[model samples]
Structures are given as C-alpha cells and as structure tokens.
Target: MTFEVFMQQLANGISIGSLYALLAIGYTMVYGILRLINFAHGDIFMMSAYFMVFGMVTFGLPWYVSAAIVIVAAVALGVLIEKAAYKSLRDAPRMSIMISAIGVSFLLENLATYLFTGVPKGFPDIDILTRAISFGNVSLSVATVVTPVVTIILLFVVLFITNKTKIGMAMRAVSKDFETARLMGININRVISTTFVIGSALAAVGAILWGSKYPSVIPLMGVMPGLKCFIAAVLGGIGNTTGAVLGGFILGMSEIMLVSFLPSLTGYRDAIAFIILIIVLIVKPTGLLGEKVTDKV
Candidate 1:
C-alpha cells in the first residue's frame, strides 16, 4: 500500500481502537471492583444506540440532545442492572454471578429484538460528525480524528477521578480489598454503583461514535464489538484501565494492519481478537501490564 493509504488505515485503526478502549475501560473497572465479567455490558452499549435512535428519529431531537439522553439512560440502566441482577448475588458463588451476567446479556438481546423487531435501524447522520477532513494526502472522517482525542481526554478524566478524588480513593480501596474497604467504613454499594455509572457513560460515548462510523444500529450490533473490547480488556490485564487503553490501540492497529497486509484475511478480521486473546492467555495470563495476583488458599 502507499504511504497515504497506510496513514489513512492507521487513522482508522486509532479511531476504532479508541472505541474499544472506551468500552474496555468499563469492563476493567467493573472487573476490578466486582470481579464480574458483566457479559451484558455490550448489551448496554446496544441499548444506548437504540436510545439515541429513539431520541433523534422517534422524538425528533437534535443529535446533542439525543446523545445526552442516551448517556443518562445508559447510566441509569447500568445502575439498575447492578442493583437488580447483581446486588442480590453479590454474596453468591462466582459461577452464580457469571451465570446471572450471561442471563442478563441474553435477556437484553432478546428483549431488544422483541421490542425493535430485529430490523436494523439506520443511524441518523450528523453532518458535523460524519464530514470528512482532508489534510494533504491523508483523508479521514471527522469521527476518526475526534474519537481518539476524546478517548484520551476521558481517560485522563477517569484517571483523575480514580487517583485524585475521594470516590476514586474509595474505589481503589474497594478494588484492592473489598472486605477491608467495608471494614474501613466505605459504602461498598455506592462505590460499585459509581463505577458502573462511569463505565456506562463511556459506553454511551462509544456507541455514539460507533454509530457515526458504521451508520447502522441493530439489537446484536454490540455483540462483536463488546466481545472484542472484552478481549482488549483481557489483553491489557483485565483490571487495569491504562492497560486496557494500550491493549485497545494494539488490537486496533494489529487488526487494521493485518487486513491491509493480507487482504484475503479481511473476512477473518473479527477472529483476530479471539486469536489474540488465546495467545495472550497462553503466553502471559496476567496480560502485558496486569499484575499477577495470587489467591489465598
């Protein structure tokens, strides 16, 4: 490929990777605190897209207003899911929580299909977002250039919250040792709920950018991206936020470069994350930046 083509693909990879990173952050934050994979997280992402569709197309709201509604709705849904599906089972066995997560995921998917009729909806176009920018030889979509910048800004915001704020301190305490954090007078439930809210909001942002990029919304739309983002989280060290971002960029770049170099493998692009997940699990289970934690007997 030519240099311009390579640059264009690189931009595409970063844009896509930024979305993965956003979703992976949610996964990592939830896992860090609850040790739950939250299989339904992707469904929440899907729901946010629908929420946007409803807000904009059904209600005739502007894109910004619809986006705000979607973010708020996603936060509420995340908290609700945690309270309804996860709270009661918090003391249950790990397997039980995992099953609940899976059930929740399936429920959301089926419910969406039933309500939306399984027909894909065309995402409304926003000229400002969908417009392409040309810089010399490299041409890129507005979202492509904007997504990574937004992801980085949000990453910093999250880091600040986790490291500089009181709630962040509480979160760190909870993640480090849940029982000890409770003993020290931390509201376990609040910390966990806050984590979900933040994660879900990020997912909402991701869904918006994703819709802008792909322009189609379906009930099952989130499944692949969710799984791939989960893989990104795993590759970065499941509980590590910075690692999650790094892994996302790596996965995105790798996938793009793979398709560019091996055009025949284009059809197998989705498989790339799975293969990476397997390789990471076999080679370094703790992930690139993940710390190895030993369970007490």
Candidate 2:
C-alpha cells in the first residue's frame, strides 16, 4: 500500500478504536461495580443508534441534536433496564444474575428485530462528517478526528467522575463493598443507577460515531463491536478504564494491520479477538492490568 493508503487505514483504525474504547468503558465500569456483564449493553448501543436514526428521519433534526437525545435516552434505558430486570436478582447468586442479563439481552435483541425488521437501514447523511482534511501525505475524515476527540473528552469526564466527585467516591466505595458502603449511608440504588447512566451515555456517543463511520444501521449492528469492545475491556484488564482504552487501540491497530499485511487472514477477523481472549485467559487470567482477586470466607 502507498503512504496515503496506509495513512487512511491508520486513521480508520484510530477512529474505530476510539469507538471501541467508549463501548468497552461501559462494559468495564459495570463489571467493576457489580461484577456483572450487562449483556444488554450491546443492544443498548444498538438502540442508541436507532434513536439517532429516528431523530433524523422522524424529527428532521441535525446529527448533534439527535446525539444529545440519544445520550439521554441511553442513560434512561440503562437505569430502567437495571431496575426492571437486574434489581430483583441483585442479591441472588452471581450466576443467576448473569443469566438474567443474558435473558434481558436476548429480549431486547428480539424486540429490536421485531420492531425494526431484519432489513438493514442506512445512516442519514451528514455532510460535515463526510468532509476530509489533508495535511501533507496524511488525510483524515472529520469523523475520524471527531471520534478520538469525543472519546478523550468522555474518558476524562468518566475519570473525573470516578476519581474527584463525591458520587465518584461512592461508586468506588460500592465497587469495593456494597453492603459496607450501604451501611455507611451510601445509596446503593442511586449509585448503581448513576453508574448505568454514565456507561450508557458513553455507549450512545460510541454508537452514534460508529454508525456515522459505517453509515449502516441494523438491529444487530452492535453485536460485533460490542464483543470486540468486551475483548478490549478484558485485554486491558476489566474495570480499568485506562486499560480499556489502551487495549481498544491495540486491538484496532492489530486487526487493521492483520488485514493490511496478511490479506489471507481477512476472513478470520472475528475469530482474532476470541483467540486473543482465550490466550489471555490461559496465560494471564487477570488480564494485562486487571487485579487478582481472592475471596475471604
């Protein structure tokens, strides 16, 4: 490939990597707090994309306007889903809660398929995102630059919330010990809802950008990216936000490089993530930056 082609691919990888990072943060954050994989998270991302499409097609709104709506809707959905499905089983066995999450995920996906049908939908055109910026031999799409910028901003905001704010302190406390934190006067319900809100909001941003880049929307659009982001979360060490982003970038670059350098392996792209995941599980179960946990009886 030529220099320009290489630059474009790199740009593509970074853009997609940032989206993966955003989605991974949601997975890691929820797992950090509850040790539950919100299986519906992928569909939540898909719903957010659908919301953006609805905003444009139904209300004739601009992309940014729809984005704000998507963020709000995603947060609300996250909190509501937790209340309706997971709350009842919070005190149950971990396996039960995980199964409930899986059920919730399947429910949402089937509902989406029923409502939206099996056909794919195209993302509405937003001229601004299509524009390109060139610097020397390097060229970048507006969405490409926007993706990383948005991810950085949201990542910083998440970090600030988890580190500096009072709610952040509560989140950290709850993640460490829910009953203990509750005994100390922390509102577990509120904190959990807030955590879901933040995670879902990030998902909304990621879904919007992912849709814009791919310009395709389907009921199942989030499946692949969601799984990949999950890999990213685990790769960097689940519950570690910084690690999630690092892993996302690495995964993105590696996948792009694999396709670019070894054309024969393009068909195995999806399997690459799982292969890495299995390798990590076998060699380093705690992940690259994950902490090893020991239960005390």
Candidate 3:
C-alpha cells in the first residue's frame, strides 16, 4: 500500500479504536467496582443512539442539543439499572447479579424494538463531523481526525479524575475492599453510582462518534461493539481503565491492519478480538497491565 493509503487506514483504526476505548472504560470501571460485567451496558449505548435520533430528527433539535439529551438519558438509564436491578442484589451471589445484568440487557433490547420497531434509522448527518477534510496527503472526515484526539483527551481526563480526585480515592479503596472502604466511611452506593454515571456518559459519547462513522442505528447495533469492547477490556485487564484503552487501540489497529494486509482475512475481522481474548486468558489472565488481586480466604 502507498503511504497515503497507510495513513488513511491508520486514521480509520484510530477512530474505531477510540470508540472501543470509551466503551471499554465503562466495562472496566463497573467490573473493578462490582465484579459484574454489566451486560446491559451495550443496550444503554444503543438506547442512547435512539435518543439522539429522536432528539435531532423527531424533535428538530440541533446536533449538540441532541447529544446533550442523549448523554443525560444514558446517565439516567445507567443509574436506574444500578438501582432497580443491581442495588437490591448487592448481597446476592455473583452469579445472581450476572443473571440480572443479562436480563436487563434483554429488556433494553426488546424495549427498543417495541419503541423503534427494529427498522434501522439513519443517523443525522452533521456537517462538522462528517465533512471531508485533507491533511497533507491524507484525506478523511473530521470525525476520523477528531476521534483519536477526543480519546486521548478523555483518557487524560479520566486518569486525572481517578488518580487525583477524592471520589477517585474512594473508588480505588472500594475496588480494593468494599467492606473496608465502607468501614472507613466511604459511601459505597455513591461511588458505585458515580462509576455508572461516568461510564454511561462515555457510552453516549462513543455512540455519537459511532453514528458519525457508521451512520446507522438499530436495536442490535450495540451488541457486537459491546461484546468486542468487553473483550478489549479483558485483553487490557478488565478492571484497569488505561489497560482497557490500550487493549481497544490494539484490537482496533490489529483488525484494520489485518484487513489491509490480508484481504482474505477481512471477513474474519470480528474473530480477531475473540482470538486475542483467548490468547490473553491463556498467556496472561491478569492482562498486560493488570495487577493480581486475591480474595481473602
């Protein structure tokens, strides 16, 4: 491939990787706190996309307005899921919470189908994000260039928040030992709620960026992305946010480069994430940057 072609592909990889990174952060955060996968997280993303569509297309709102609305809706939905489904199950077995998460996922999917009729909706075209632009020899859309930048900025923001803030300290303490943190006067519920709020908001942002690139919305739209992001989280260390971001970039780059180098493997792109997951599990279960955490026996 030519240099320009390589650059284009790199841009594509970064854009998709950024979205994966955003979603993967959500997975890692929740898992770090509760050790639950939050299977419904993907559906929350899908629902956010629909909220965008309705806000922009149905209500004649602007893109920024729609996006704000989507974020608020996603945050609300995430907190609701935590309260209605997860909070009550706090004292229950791990398997029970997992089951609840799965049920919530199904409920969101079905509810979206009932409301949106499963007909794929076109994502509104925002000229600013979708407009074509040139960078030296690289020609791409604004979103392509913006995505990685956004991801990097957000990464720093999240890292700073988790590393510098008081709530972040509480989160770290809780992740290490829930009961101990509570004994230290950390409100477990508040920290968990904050995690969900941040995670779901990130999901909304990812969904908006996804719309810019893919430009189609459907009830099942989030399923594959959700699964892959989860895999990305696992590949990076499920409870480590930075690792999740790193894993996302790796998966995104690998998938795109695979298609670029081996056309025959293009159809097998999705399989790559799973293969990486398997390799990570076998080679390093704690993930590349993951710390080993042992339960007190």
Candidate 4:
C-alpha cells in the first residue's frame, strides 16, 4: 500500500479500535468487580442505537438532545439489568451469573426483534458528525476523525474516576476483597451500580459513533462487535482497563491491515479476532496484564 493508502487504513483502524476499546472497558470493569462476563453488555450497546432512533426520529429531538437522552436511558437499562438479573445471584455459583448474563443477552435480542420487527432502521444522519471530510489525500467522515479523540478523552476521565475518587476506592476495595469491603462500610451495591453506569455510558457513546460510521440499526447488530470487544478484553487482561484498550487497538489494527494487505482474506476478518483469542488463551490464559486468581475450595 502507498503511504496515503496506509494512512487511511490506519485512521480507519484507530476509529474502529476506539469503539472496541470503549465497549471492552465495560467487560473489564464488570469482570474486575464481579468475576463475571456481562454477556448483555453488547445488547446494551445495541439497545442504545434503538434508543437513539426513538429519541431522534420518533421524538423529533435535536441531535445533541437525543444523544444525551439516549446515554441516560442506556445507563438506566444497565443498572436495571444488573439489579433485576444479577443482583440476587451475587452469592450464587459463578455459572449461575454467567448463565443469567447469556439469558439477558438473548432476551434483549428477541425483545428488540419483537418490538422493532427485525427491520434495519437507518440511523438518523447527525450532520455535524456524519458529514464527510477531506484530510489531504485521505478523505474520511467527521466521525472517523473524531472517534479516537473522543474515546481517549473519555478513557482518561474514566481512569481518573476509577483511580482517584472515593467510588474508585470502593471499587478497588471490593475487587480485592468483596466481603471485607462490605464489612468496612463500602456499599457493595452502590459500587457495582456505579461501575455499570460508567460502562453503559461508554457503550452509548460507542454506539453513537459506531452508528455514525456503519449507519445500520438492527436487533442483532451488536453481536459481532460485542463478541469482538470481549475478545479484546480477554486479549489484554480481562480485568485490566488499560490492557483492554491496548488489546482493542491491536485487534482493530491487525484486522484492518490484514485485509488491506491481502484483500482475499476479507472474509476472515471476524475469524481473526477468534484466532487471536485462542492464541491468548493457550499462551497466557490469565491475559497479558491479568493477575492469576486462586479460587477458594
């Protein structure tokens, strides 16, 4: 590929990577605290898209207003799902929580299909972000140029919240010793809910940027992306936030560049993520940055 071509592909990779990173953080955060993979996270992201369509098209709201409302709605949905499905199962076996997560995923999928009739809705064109722009030889959409920047800013904000704030301290304490944190007066439920709130909000932002780039809204749209982001979380160390981001960028870059370099392999883009996941599991099951956990007998 020529320099310009490579630059374009790189830019595209970064945009895609940032979206994966946002979603992957959700997986990492939940796993860090609960030791459970939230299979419903991607569905939550999917719901955010429908939320956007309803707010923007049905309600006839402005783009900014609709975006804000959708983010809030997504957060509420996350908390509700956690409380309704996972809360009671907190003390249950790990398998029980995992099964509930899967169940929630399917429920959202079918619920969306039943409500929306499996039609692919057009994501309303938010002119400011969706408009195409020319950056020298490589032309791209405004969202393409803006996604990574926004993701980086948000990542820093999340990092600060988790590392420096009181809630962050509570989260860390809970992750280290859940029983002890509760004993020390940390509200376990509150910390978990806050984690969900942050995760869901990031998913909302990711969905908006993703919709702007892909512009398709369907009940099952989140399946592939969601799974890929999970792979990214695992690849980087499922419980580590920064590791998740690193894995996302690497996954996105590799997938994009692989296809760009060898067009014939375009069909294997999805497989690439799985292959990486398999290698990571075999080589370092705890993930690159994940600590080995020893469960009590």
**List of clashing residue pairs for candidate 2:** none
Model 2 misplaced stretches (Cα beyond 4 Å): none
lDDT of 2: 0.88
Flag regions of model 4 displaced more than 4 Å. Answer: none
Better of 3 and 4 by lDDT: 4
TM-score of 3: 0.98
Error of 3 at 101 (Å): 0.6
Q: Which ten residues in a row are the worst by lDDT in model 1? A: 288-297
Ranking by lDDT: 1, 4, 3, 2
Give each model's clash number.
0, 0, 0, 0
lDDT per residue for candidate 4 within 138-213, as digits (tens), equals: 8888998999899889889989998999999999999888888899999999999999999999999999999999
Candidate 2 TM-score over all chains jointly: 0.96
Residue range with the least summed lDDT across 10 consecutive positions in model 2: 288-297
User: On lDDT, who's better, 2 or 4?
Assistant: 4
Across residues 1-297, which tens digit of lDDT does each residue of candidate 2 receive?
888888888888888888889999999999988888888899899999889889998799988898899899999999999999988888888889999988888888889999989788887777788688887988777889899888988889999999999999999998888778989999988888998999999999888888778888888888888899999999999988888887888788888877887889999988888888899899988788889865423
- What TM-score fits each model? 0.99, 0.96, 0.98, 0.98
Better of 2 and 3 by lDDT: 3
List, residue by residue over 241-268, the lDDT tens digit for candidate 3: 9999998999899899889988899899
